[model samples]
Target: MPQHHDPGTADAPEGQASKSGFRPTAVAAVELGVVGQSVGVTVPGASESVQVTGISLDSRTVERGDLYVALPGAARHGADFARTALEAGAVAVLTDDAGARLLALGSDIAVPVLVVAEPRSVVGRLSRLIYRSQDADLPGPSMFGVTGTNGKTTTTYFINALLQAMGKKTGLIGTIEILAGGDPIPSLLTTPESTDVHALLALMRERGLDAASMEVSSHAVSFRRVDGVVFDVVGFTNLTQDHLDLHGTMEEYYRTKAELFTAERARAAVVTVDDEWGRRLAAQTELPVTTLATIQPGSGPEADPAGPAGADWTVTDSKPRGLGTEFTLRGRNGTELRVHTGLPGAFNVSNAALALAMVLAGGADPAEVQAALDSKDPFTVAVPGRMQLVSTRPAAVVDFAHNTDALARALAAVRSPEPASKVIVVFGATGQRDQGKRPSMGATAARLADVVIVSDDDPHDEDAAAIRAEVLVGATDAKEAEQLDCKIMEVYPRDAAIREAVNLAAPEDTILIAGRGHEVWQEVKGVNLALDDRVELRNALTARGFTVLQDDGIES
Candidate 1:
């Protein structure tokens, strides 16, 4: 049996009170009425007096005196679990008016129900109220949010490393791990739910951090996972075709990402005008916008010149080297700084510049930014799955380039150097995602790689073979075009595919394993199994008696 409490007093027993921490603050007062009115449900329990300590979507995570939000999903209405949540010690339930009516008619639920229209929309405000109250007592570190279709993880890593180089205590939340100082915490999602997000921010606030960099995914933006929180700087790397399955269209996907910049709370915006979408976002956003670009030598018209003319910061004279990259950053007031990044790829130059712009916008010195870039080897802080080199003989690189645009970039980066060497790639499309991109990905891989091996990548209840067939369409097209003598192999098992690719590689060959960077688990038929691409590559290489080099010191 669960203990019931009056609206105003603490009801959980002894040690549980410390574990639960359910004391409600002033945000709850205003949120209750706003949510109640929005949903057309009269505030049933004490509105002015009632307090909710935390918000949760899962009934299993509900603690004593917490508010459980019952949202509707594709499979079922979350309100069905209201009774279970009450039994698990939930103080109240926030649901739609229709859901409340159903619950009222179904059973006599002792817990108070607050019904609102479009509960998901109002959830952001409610969560903001509940969590933002703690902002005064525990102000966040200078938080930075990075978004876009590609280069998010790499850009995030560079920013974290640069901040650390400038002698600031930093925390990171991205595709790889969550860091509080030097300790790494495993991540379950690229961007966690709003409640978890606020809780993590609260933890960082307690850790005396000076800065924090987080990856804001499209899903996070669309679902309001980052709602109610303020960002010191929000950056856009580039946008491409991905996650259309959830957003329904490219315009909607772009709009969902635009939410972060349009957000009234973002203090500054940094965008890469290398892509057209990025250029448009920079032009429309009202916040202080800084544009960056990495134009290859002798390229056509530069992507977005409007920002360089009107905006406060821009990057120019971009040149790539084998050791690192060199560029000139021009500020709005005619300030120029020669910047050298110890990271590969012309794309990385853009990522580094974005980080520099973010740090500068946050009041860090331009000289300090340059000093950070020069102080350490930029490659030292390489993200685990992004261009992560696992073998030396064939020089295999594992990256999370899942989409056509990102795939093209990764392949280009790999083939840029050693033009004579063959680029062999192993990749697969994700299940239940934008199926339109499948043939495009296949075509890209077939055109780029000397040997293309298609394998499983998070089938997730979708037919793995059918996904491969779609990818093969592009590969078939590439082969039919007579681009090169390309070999197409279908390996169902990812590990076996990796082994086969490595075994077939020569000293001059570069094998790129794409589609699952930094992820440790593979979801097949809804079950998450331990499967790391880097680990498997390393083990296979060692088993075959290959001496892997410390790092490939390749210049961009």
Candidate 2:
């Protein structure tokens, strides 16, 4: 419990910290002055001094001399784990008033217990301090952020690839995994918890990573998951109606995303003004904005001149080639960047362009960034689940197009003109998410694809049938609106749905399995079962006597 050490003191063993790239930063747990000044959260108790080396939200990961942050959990109070965490070498405790009261029933609690009004809110600032991201000498990774309803994952991936292609050692933190200098480390949240984020940044710095491409989810921004982190460059993909349950309204959602582009969050920005939301966001941001558009750049129904998106860049002459595409990127600076990408679709072209602009904003020479694209392996990155092609012959593609907008794009991308006969799409609605998108998604599939097989996606306590019914309503509505009878089938499990979609496909026909792209598990009734669309689609295709094409490692 001694606090008479340097704030930068490390209690970690000689080489123990180096393995995970952890640098222990200790602070006297008795000091809550920073928290008081930051968010007006006070520690009412007369605290005894303890050397806190780390911070943790979960008791399971608590290290020796750690400050266990006891936040209010959904099931129970996190203070319940305070004793457990302390038992596992936690030196002090930080929590809410209720959590403090709960800890008070025990006389054995000797460590400093600081009760703040909003424990979760201040945890980020505290974590930033404890992890040394705020330290001047650390010079942490150059963070690049991508935010939107769709294309966040793909854009971040593209940004990471671009950074790597430019010869910088990079890390990636997004929906899929945290790649430390291109090494894959599994992740749970799109944007990790504040402590995890700061810690990862610290790790990336210590491990010699020069840059990182991170997905900035609106939830993370609203929840203060990214409170203390700053980005060198940020990109905005178009926003849509999603996460309504968390944000409550599209306006609130937009504002939350807008938080990232503020001078406090990012230094420079690149935004795709294909939608009005991005245009509006670009106008409001204090950072310098480089607007991009896949559609009409400066005029017509798509352009919003009233907002900030008076396009500075546009994707022109974009020609899709199977799983890849070639496009001419034109910027207001009069630089015509010719881009060839393994990533398919106009949306991907927009993503690559935004990535190029972001890297340029992040201090990469535009000519060099453009030159990286033409290198034999330039921009040949295949993002998992974002338009991931898993098969050939009766071609099957897996995409993480869970929402209506994303689904429409995925369908359009795979709906080939000549080679493919029928575009058979198998998709499902996630339970307990934006229910409004169910019908819209179904309708989009109905309008775009030749056949639709609706199935389950993370049923998570809701009846899969009910969610499917809502999506089916959209399919029905599409049929009614167009006065055309479209083929629709309801499948309970996703594997059956994949098989059905594959079975219904001909050699020339395309099979698109939307939702659950690179996700390796299916959430059902509280348990997550191993299930991946790419794997399942491949299995289904192999069972149908089709020799699935060899998976080229570097290419899709």
List model 1 lDDT by residue over 1-556, tens digit each.
4543321111222223213222122222334544455446677546634565677776655765567888776655677777777877777788887678768887787767876677777666666666562366656689899999988887888788878888888988877777867567656568766765665666676667889998999988877777777898999988889999999899999988888997575988988776678878999998888776555333533354433344556667877765357888788788777777655566767777787777887788877777766776453476778777766557778888999988887887777366578888889999988999999999888877888999989898999999998898789887888655889989879999988888887777888999997777787886777788887777777777787755633221
lDDT of each: 0.74, 0.77
TM-score, model 2 to reference? 0.90
Most TM-score-accurate candidate: 2
Clashing pairs in 2: 421-508
Kindly report which residue pairs in candidate 1 clash with one another. Answer: 39-116, 39-117, 321-555, 322-555, 443-474
Cα RMSD to the true fold for all candidates = 6.1, 5.9
The global Cα lDDT (0 to 1) of model 2 is 0.77
lDDT of 2 by residue, 397-452 (tens): 88888888888888887876765389899999999998888999999889988888
